[model samples]
Structure formats: structure tokens, C-alpha cells
Target: MITPTSDRGTKQVHDGQDFVEFTRTFRAPAEDVWAAVTDPGRLARWIGSWRGDPADGEVWFRMLFEGDEIPEEHMAIHQCDAPHRLRVTSTSPSEEGPQVWDFRIDLVEANGVTTLTFAQSVPDAQLAEGVGPGWQYYLDRLMLAETGADPADIDFDDYYPALKEHYRELFA
Candidate 1:
């Protein structure tokens, strides 16, 4: 149900059972895109604060989504490979559910261009519907920041509400 903003397209999968996937092609090299996503310092510039080193079996800092100051204790890093792929696992603490969010980031290089594919698979329908727009916004910001440009200052607190409404209107 993600409302299309600025011609940025979105797609839904699995009757809302599978996680919403967002893909964008960045005009940067695959190495640079991968670094921006996997490198803690680079990631913080675009996304949020990241703690601990990124490695296999290492619990990196929880991503402070949009408005929340306290990182969710239920988040963790599952796997990471430089300039290629990363997988993260996240859970919702508000519910007594065992659902895990599997985020897979893949980088494809061809003809001096890079396509960054971000796929987040959540088991819950509600979460999937809500997360679609959030990821789109953040990834848009990430692309801008990587290109040595300042993205419009976005208030993280307003992200969820706007996205939720957008999703409902688009997919309703």
C-alpha cells in the first residue's frame, strides 16, 4: 500500500506475507555503494548510529529507526561481506512474536554502473506494509549522501506516520 512519492516505484509481494523489496540503481561504483551501506562510519552518515564492528556472528548496534533514540534491543547483524552483501535480523519487542526480519543487501556491477538491491523480508503483514516506504525514504537519502550532497533535512519522527498513510492510500 505504499503511495508513490516522486515517481519512486514500489512493489508488494506474497499478499503482504513476504517482506517488501526496494531496488534502486545508484550512479556510484559498486565498491562505494557497498562501503556506504556496510561501513559503520559511512552507514551512520546516511542511516543512523551504528555500534560494534560488522562481521559474521557479531552483534552490531541496533539501528535507531527514524524517531526512536534508543536502538531496539531486538536487532542484530547476521552476516556481512564487503562491497557485496549484508544480512540483518530484526524483531519486534512489542509483541510476543518470533518473527525475524531478514534484510539482504546485494550489489551488482555492470558496465561501470552499480545497482544496489535492498530486500527486506519480514514475516508479519503489518510490518511489511509499514516498512516499505520507510526503506524507500532512507535509501533515497543514502543515495544522495553518497554523492557528496546534503539531502533535505528529514525529521525521523514523521517518517512512520507519513509512510503508513502513503502505503494505505497506494495499496488500499
Candidate 2:
């Protein structure tokens, strides 16, 4: 059974931009957590995999969980500090037009536990309704993946509608 309290994200404003953030702590080290989020092969175990070199400041990411019909997303790496921090902008196509998302990940370790903070800058509460639950689901999968557990065990249905109101209230 999935716990209702699994949603621990918060909404915040930084530098005049609104953001929805989620934080997860792992007993593993920062390096392991970092690899889970950055390494293409490791990421494939949870969310998605990427191609192209990050040193080029961009990569193409194809989500493995979403099936093969979805197009690959283009991500521009703004900042990357191995095993610690990462900032990127993701651009994808939508019915309205091109959608761009700004994301930031930061990690801190102390006495073996590594804490990862994931944030996405959003324009409004409407956007966060989906973004919040989506990230919560993905981050939970990430936690499972790092522990060698099957991330596939998690269902997207557990997140979306269940937490949509929660996110709407937070951003509203």
C-alpha cells in the first residue's frame, strides 16, 4: 500500500520565481545519490536515460517509463557540480507550443545520509498540479531504485489525482 504521507514536497519562492520542491534522504552517500540522478544508466532504472555529453551543455533524454511513443526531451545543463548540484532547463513540445522547465537538484551529506532536494520552477499553480505529483512519483521511484528495489512497483495512479489538490493548495 502506498502511504499518503509520501508527499513531502513544499512550494516556495526564490529570486522572485515560484518553485515546487521535494526532498529525499537516503542512507547512501552523496555520490550514490548523485549517480542515481545524473548517470544515464542509473537514471534508466528509475525515471529516464539521456544521450549526448553533458559537457556540451545539452543532452537528449528519453523517458523509459512513459513508453516509446513520447518524444525525447532536450535538456540544457546550466550548472553541474558532480555529486552535489545540478541545474538544467528541459524543453519539450506541447499542444500549445514549446514547454520549458527549469529544474534544480542539490545534495548534502552528513554521517552517511545523503539528502537530495529537487525543485522545479513553475509559472503558476495550474502547472504545479501536474508537476508536483509527477516529481513525487519519480522521486519515490528513485529512492526505490537506489535500494535495488523495483521502481516499477510504484504506480503513477498513486500520485496524480491523489496529490493534485495538495499541490494546488500549496501553490494557490
Candidate 3:
């Protein structure tokens, strides 16, 4: 079990915009880790899935939950270096209005271990309380997938409201 209080760090980026960064190391090769992150089938096992054409300059991103239903949005891929780095931007409707957010993913290898780094700018500081653990759970799911664990074994309840307080304290 992962301690809710660990595995994540917060930062202020560019004019005090708050963001959260997460890093996880996989015992697999960088190529294998990259496939797990970018491949739609593998991603659906962990976080969300994509549907749009990348050559078209955009793609459809669907956020998969515990059920068949999902919430999706369009994301523009600003840059991608297969198996290494990706930068993307997307806007989604929120109670606070349409929010544009940035996401970056990086993979690096050294001495036979591969590390995955993820960073995203928070649209609202208060949301950090939820975002932190949400990503943590997803990354954990990714680990389970790469290890051949069943995705059905994952329970979203363990992340969201369950670990909300732990993340809230981090944001606080």
C-alpha cells in the first residue's frame, strides 16, 4: 500500500501558478514503460483512453471510471518524442468555467531502471486536494497493469474521497 502522504510533490510554476508533479519507477525497460504509457490499450487499463487522430493535430481523451460510462474531451498534442516526452494542452468545462490545463510526461532510464515523471498545472489550487491522490491511484493502476495484474481489481474509492484529506493537507 502506498502512503497517501508520499509519492507526490507540489510546486509553483511561472508567476506562481501551482502545479503537482508525480514520479514512479518501473522495474521494466524504458521501451516497455513507454508502450504502457502511450499505447491506447494499455492506457485504458490505467487512466483514460484516446480516440482522435494525432496527425490531425488533436485527439479525443476519455476519462474511464469504474464503469462503462466515461467523460471525454479534446486535447492537442503540442509535442511528442516517442517513449520519452510528451506535452499536451486541453480545455474542459468546469464549474469555474472552461479550464485549460497543461500536462507533461517524461520517461528516463539509467542502470536498468525506468522512471516515469508526470507534471500538470492545477487549474484551481483547491482542486489539488483531489488531483494529487487521483493521479497517484492512476499511476498505481499503471503499475498493476504492467505487472499483469487485473484492472478489475482496482477500486476508485481507494483514491478519491477516501484519500482526499491526505492530499488536502499537502495543499494546505
Candidate 4:
């Protein structure tokens, strides 16, 4: 069951900069979760697919968040640490020069369960409220794909304004 955003715990961290972190514990193994994240084939099921070797350093890839109508956003793989962490940074071209955000995915296993920590940091702190629900929904898709659930189709309407309001209230 999907819990209400009001009930979920999200924290803001600052190491001289701001970061929004979301945590989820899966009853699956760490390696399994890691594979789902690292493999482009599996990632396509939830978020967009990648086509690069992170080991070789910053590799560029296209991101597809919405359907075919939306243009793919060019993103780059910033870092990859196997079944432990995956870091990515993306710059969106705009008249304002470029908008950038860093995504960090960290995984750890203990007592047969794996815990995934997903975080996103940007220069503007206000962005977190808008991003909170988006990441939650994507992670939910990750859980569905990992658990062998049936064909999963994510609806943006189910998350956006709904959780966005919650995030705004909480972060405000």
C-alpha cells in the first residue's frame, strides 16, 4: 500500500549545501536492487534508460521522463560505485544558461534486507518540494519492478500536485 506523503518521513540535509533525502527499505537483497538500478534494461521500466559506462567517468545519456511527446533530456553519469552508490548529474539547457541537479542513490544491506537512500541536491532549495513526490513515485516504480509485480504503468497525476502540496507544507 502506498502511504500518504504526510506520513512519510523525508529529511533535509546540509553539508554547506542543501539536499533532500528519501529512504526506503526493501525486503530484497542489495545486489538485486543494485542490478535493477545499474542495468539500463531494468531502469527503462521505471525511469529512463542509460547508455554509458560510468566506470569511464562522466558519460552522457538521454533521459525520458514522460512519454514520446516530451523531448529527452541530456544527462551525464557522474559516478558509479557498483552495488553501493550511483551518482548522476544533469544540466538542462535554457535561456538562463543551464539548470543542474545531482542525484545520489545509495544502497546497503543488513539482516537480509536492503535499504535504499535516494537524494537530490540543487543550488535552489525550493526545488526540493517539487522533486520530493517525483522521486517517491520513481522509487515506488523501482520497488514494483524489483518485486516481480505485473506490468506497471505510472501515472503522473497520482503523484505531482498531490504530494507536491504535502512537500510544500512540510518544507515550508
TM-score of each candidate structure, all chains considered together: 0.73, 0.95, 0.84, 0.82
lDDT of 2 at 72: 88
RMSD of each: 4.5, 1.3, 2.7, 2.8
Which model scores highest in TM-score? 2
Give one digit per residue, the lDDT tens place, for model 1 in 1-172. Answer: 2222353424445335455666778777889888887767787777765555444364545454455664354457666776787777766454465556667788888877888878777555465456766787787778667777664555444555656655544444
- Over the full model, what C-alpha lDDT does candidate 1 score relative to the true structure? 0.64
Per-residue alpha-carbon lDDT of model 2 for 1-172, expressed as tens digits? Answer: 4443365689887668899998999998999889889989899999899999998999999899988888888999999999899999999988899899889999999999998999999898898899899899999888888887788787889888988998888889
lDDT of 4 at 69: 57
- Count: clashes, candidate 2: 0
Q: Residue 48: error of model 4 in Å?
A: 0.8
Tell me the spans in candidate 4 whose CA falls farther than 4 Å from its real position.
Answer: 1-9, 69-78, 151-153
Q: Kindly give the stretch of ten consecutive residues in candidate 2 with the minimal lDDT sum.
A: 1-10
Query: What local distance difference test score does each model get?
Result: 0.64, 0.88, 0.76, 0.70
Misplaced by over 4 Å in model 2 are: 1-5
Worst 10 residues of 3 by lDDT: 1-10
Clash count of each predicted structure: 2, 0, 0, 0
Off by over 4 Å in 3: 1-6, 12-16, 66-69
Global CA lDDT computed for model 4: 0.70
lDDT score for residue 145 of model 2: 82
